[model samples]
Target: MRVGSTMLVRQNLTRKLSRSILLVICIGIAFFVFGVLSSFRAGFEGSEANSERLVVASKIGGNETLPLRYFQQLGGMDEIAEVTHVTRLRAHTAGNERNIIGANAVDAQSYASVYADTYDFNAEIMQAFQADRTATLVGRQLAEREGWAVGDRVNLTSFVHMTQDASRDWSFVIAGLLDGAEPTVDTNFLIVRYDYFNAALLRNQDQVNLFGIKPAVGTDINVLAETIDMTFANSTAQTRTQSETAFMSAFLEQFADVALIVKLIVSVSFGTILLIVANTMIFAIRERTLEIGVLKVLGFSGSSIMRIILTETLVLFAAGLALGFALTAAVIPVLGDALSSVVPDLYLTPKVVATSVGLAVVFAVLTGFLPAIKALRLPVATALNHR
Candidate 1:
């Protein structure tokens, strides 16, 4: 019975080659969009899965700075594993804002120790940073984009705080380059010694932008964050502390309502595919009314007739989905640089692939149902008597 049903579906599909090809193309395009957008949403959240760190920033927005002394006090806490200070210089390359990269000043030893796994810290790189105060370590992505190498000198023009002389005067020698082992590590930052930046901004002693803290094993992060805030409650520099995941999530929230946006996009994309498939199925059924009646008259049950139509729809959708996934894989690599900065962690996971294919099948079955039922309800004598 199944064999006869399969043969019938193939004949109908071949009879209308143009319609079959068009529907397959539509399904493929829809699935491609689904694969890429879903990957982006997942990539954004994936960055927050690391369990060991926290970010301490100002409660109020803007260029509010914390006193450097807080770093010492925070490091002394029992629940804290280590603390590192990060100040965003907000500087650009020689007054070119287009060359905007993260310019951070941090303690070399502490920073390296805390993020050893993320950043490839070798003795040679460490030695260069230690020996020279004017040296900086850049991320691999930034280096490749700007065509920089070791021993190259890069000059940055300060944007946040300008010198009295109006001279944009800060420069660093490229001592090393670092790459993240995982996608979460934000490999677009530049690291320099805090003392170098602090010494240069001695007059503006109160300005330190952010603090990165590592929590001790088994410590409650929520409790520790509250404690850190309370410790500096009376001080002039008020602080807000959160786990690394929460910290990164807060920053992403500033861009857009990510969850809502992703939901809306997915809903709309699938809804479009549903309508397309339904319309196609309706047309297919209209064209095949005579054929369906002949099959029923030949002793095929309603269930078998339904199965044949559903199988045709499923096959068409599957072909399109496979083609779309292949196209996505081939295209993403060519846009590597553009995507690296925008969607740093974007990649097609096995789960995403499975979900996309599953959605295609589910939607095809759902949209094809009404047409299948309509064909199943046709009387053999009436269907055969029709033109």
Candidate 2:
């Protein structure tokens, strides 16, 4: 019975090639957009999955700078495993004023120890960085995008903190390329030696932009965070400490309401798919009214007729969805370089693909339900009496 129904659907589609192709195209586009958008949202949220790390920043706000001495205090706690400081330096590459890079001065050893899983740091690279005061480690994606390599000199012009002469004084040699082990460690960042930046701005000795902290095993992160904050309560630079996940979430919140935006986009995309499939089903049922009546007259039960129609709709939607997902999976990796800066770690994981396909199937089933019911309810006698 199922085989017959499948054959019937194929015949119907083959007979009306243009309409079938149009339907497939519409469904394919909707699925493609759905898959891409869903993956992007997932990527955004996945940026903060590290369990053992935390970030300490100025209590005033995200942009406020914290004191470098705060790290020394945090490091003194038995509950704290390690502490590293980072300072944001918004700068452009040398000679090319148009080319911009998001660079940060970081304590490399501490950073590597904390995020060893996300960053593959070798002994040679660490030794080179430690030995050369002017050395910098660039993200793999950034290096590829900018055509940089080891031993290459790149000067950065600071936008936030400029020199009195209006000349960019910051420069570093690319010692190694840093590749993120996961999607969360933003691949567009350049990690330079924090000591270099500190030495350069000795007059501004107290300022450190952010501190990355790793908690000791079995320590309660919340309790330790509170303890660190209380220790700095009377300080000139107040502190705010949170888990690494919360740190990334805080940054994301500054841009937009991520949850609301993701919900809106998914809702709109699903609605568009519903309308497209529903409209296509309506037209298909209208055109096949006489055929449906013939089947009804030939002893096809209402339930059987409904099943056939639903099956056809499922086949069409499935084909389109499969095509779109395959295309997305193939294209996303190839365009990694172009999209890395904008949608860092944009790749179609298995979970993302499965969820997208499931969404398409659900929408297809819902949209086809009405048309299937309409076909099933057609009276044999009445349909036969019509032209």
For candidate 2, the lDDT comes to 0.78
Top-scoring candidate (TM-score): 2
RMSD per model, one decimal: 3.3, 3.3
Per-model TM-score versus the true fold: 0.84, 0.85
Clashing pairs in 1: none
lDDT of 2 by residue, 231-293 (tens): 989988898888877777677778986767877877887688788778878887887788888
| Each model's lDDT | 0.79, 0.78
Model 1, range 333-376, lDDT digits (tens) per residue? Answer: 55444666656666776778999878878987998898999988
Q: After superposition, which runs of candidate 1 have C-alpha atoms over 4 Å from their true positions?
A: 1-5, 39-52, 163-166, 183-186, 220-238, 258-262, 339-351, 373-386
The residue pairs in collision within model 2 are none
State how far residue 94 of model 1 sits from its true place (Å): 1.1
